[model samples]
Target: MKVLVGADIGGTKLALRTTTPDGTVRVDVEIPSTGWEAAPVDQAARWLLDRVRPVLPEDDEIAALGVGAQGCDTQEHCAHLAAAFEALGVSAAVVNDAALLVPAAGLTDGIGVIAGTGSIAVGACAEGTVLFAGGWGWVLGDEGSAPAIVREAAKAALAAHDKRRPDDGLLSELLAHYGVADAPALARAVNDTPTPATWGPAAPAVFRAAASGSASALAVIDDAATHLTALVSRLRARGAVGETVVAAGSVVLGQPLLAARLRERLGSAHPDLTLRLLDVPPVAGAVALARARYGLAGVA
Candidate 1:
């Protein structure tokens, strides 16, 4: 039998799904994306193939494959990955992982926002040219993402300390979370090793502080929401064709406050756009794209 394969490759993990043309799921599994690298296309292709080969049924052949990759920021990058896959004897379509959200929500055209370890917004114009905003990674941007929230929260807390302002609980929350006794130590803890693994885990402390009445934490969250909203607006300004915004990823999906704030801001800024949380795993979108692109079936 011929099978369609799809994969959603994020910074933390890769989710793979395989289904027959009729949408019967055959294999669904997730694995760490540890060795995966998007650049040097051949290496990316090999990394994907290594994982995929074991999960697929021995008797089945892959008719088409769709991939949503985290580091595939540009069309050229995606095309390079696709060519690499083709060279390795697999027919594949590759896109930025954020692009999976719209199709995962079962929409043909819309905007996708991901706020997990990192954040990015993706959409396409009338000509199907993909557009992007934000997604500068944790250090510089990725404003609604978990690591970014923690990064900003730390900065806020440190600023308050330097000014001799009263602790709004944000500083204490961060200090406790990082197991540091004072503000300077907290700065050292956060600044010494600035990675998603280190910073993302502390994001919940920011939200907790906010819930416990920390104005600084609330302001950080509000700013994050605003930045997320701006990503969609930027996409629209660049002629992205979509009336809906589909959001996914751990930060947005797991944090009700952030989700609510984003909804409120998006409503105020783009009243015409509708916000929807993706209920399905994003690999479903890759599967749908594979089916559609291969003339097997429309999105499911």
Candidate 2:
């Protein structure tokens, strides 16, 4: 069997797995990322190599290495990553984390929506026609991401405080979650960090509050779905993909309302376009792509 290693690196977490052709993580390690801007690519590569080395078989040569990282898609970034891998004593192919989602979804090509710390959407055709919408990161775009929802939820709370709206479940629960008993403290904390991924943990809180019939929180969830669907719609309209879209990432998979809203929105844009949920993890998708590349699967 061909030996391959797959790594999924993000801003906050890093996941590394060693597997054979069938996508089993015989040995896996999850670690904290040193931050996107803080750690250089070479440093990250070394860190991953350290974790993967122990799991590798002494007699097995690494046939190929596939990396799924948050910002590895761009040419400049990928070059640095490739150089980093070279420094770490591994020749590897690196790609955008979203690109790996295609095979992870068990589809050769389709639209992928990743709703995690931040949000982004990707569309691909069977022939390798890839397109992207959103994914501007937490600062610029990243609508429908967890941070986006938290940011909006915070805004709504402040607005209610200013307008003398009821200090109901939405505002009250938000303050408690953030460890602030008042609107001013919440505002200060939000402004202090102000990063999109920073608010990721709050995405669940938004869902919880919404589930309890909080109008404001529900509105936030609806808005997130609307934004995400808009991206999917644009990709479909541009002929970047076919009729089916696959939803990936924690927010899309973990939150039922977000998924329902995405389906609803997609139904309006392309009634024939079916929205499916990806049950497998992205690391599995990375192995799927690796299998395809090594001539182990049907792609050959």
Candidate 3:
């Protein structure tokens, strides 16, 4: 029997799964993606080998491996990863983690929109040139992402407090959520640790505030949806008019209201757009790529 593996390496999680030719998953492995984007190419490869080695059957050959990672945003990064894996005595394919969104949603071609720790959209233009938007990371631009939402929520809370409300609803909620005493303390805490992992989890505070009719929270959501929409709009402007636009990630998927608002907002531009929420984990896209690329049916 052959054992083929696929991986989705994100900012928070590194997931690996082995699948049969029939697409039956046999094994799944997950590990922390602590500093993966900063790690050297060889270090990342060794990280994968170290974890995946002990899980699958040693007798079966590695039919193929495909990895879609947050760090593999650049073509050079993708090629480096591909070389590193193939050097490990297996054929490999590597791509940006955002690229996995469309395929994971069961589309051979479409726009892939991801809004988790960060946000990015990938698609091909009319001339078949692959185009990208967002994915600028936390510091630069992760609009509509969790960290971005958290930052905005914090700002909203602080702004509300500055309006001399004494103690506003969102301000209180954020203060409690971050375990901070007040706005000043919250600002210090946020500025101190401005990482996706830290701020991403706090995004729920915004939704919670919105649920209770917080105008500031609702505005933040509206702005976030608009920012995310701009990614697709930019693609459309460039003539990347894909029929389907698949959305994944906790921000959009975890919040139904955000999804509805996005769909409503998009109706004007993409009237015939087929919006899909990714049902399967992004790692499955890598598995599919491995199976098709390597023709794993006979190998297994």
Model 3 CA lDDT for position 196:
76
- Clashing residue pairs, candidate 1? none
Instruction: List all candidate RMSDs to the true structure.
Output: 1.2, 2.9, 2.4
Tens-place lDDT digits, model 3, residues 1-300: 676688888878888899767667788878887757524777787787776777786575678887888866666777887888778777888778888887677677788888888899888766756678888887788888999988888888888778876553677778778898978998988888877777888888888888888888888888888888899989878877568899988788999988987887777667878778899889988887788777753333
- Candidate 2: give the clashing pairs: 104-285
How big is the positional error of residue 123 in model 2, measured in Å on the Cα after superposition? 1.9
The local distance difference test score of each candidate is 0.93, 0.74, 0.81
TM-score of 1: 0.97
Which candidate do you rate higher for lDDT, 2 or 3?
Answer: 3
TM-score of each: 0.97, 0.87, 0.92
- Poorly placed runs, candidate 1 (over 4 Å): none
What's the CA error at residue 26 for candidate 2, in Å?
2.0
What is the lDDT ranking, best to worst? 1, 3, 2
Per-structure clash totals for the candidates: 0, 1, 0
lDDT of 3: 0.81
Ranking by TM-score: 1, 3, 2
Highest lDDT scorer: 1
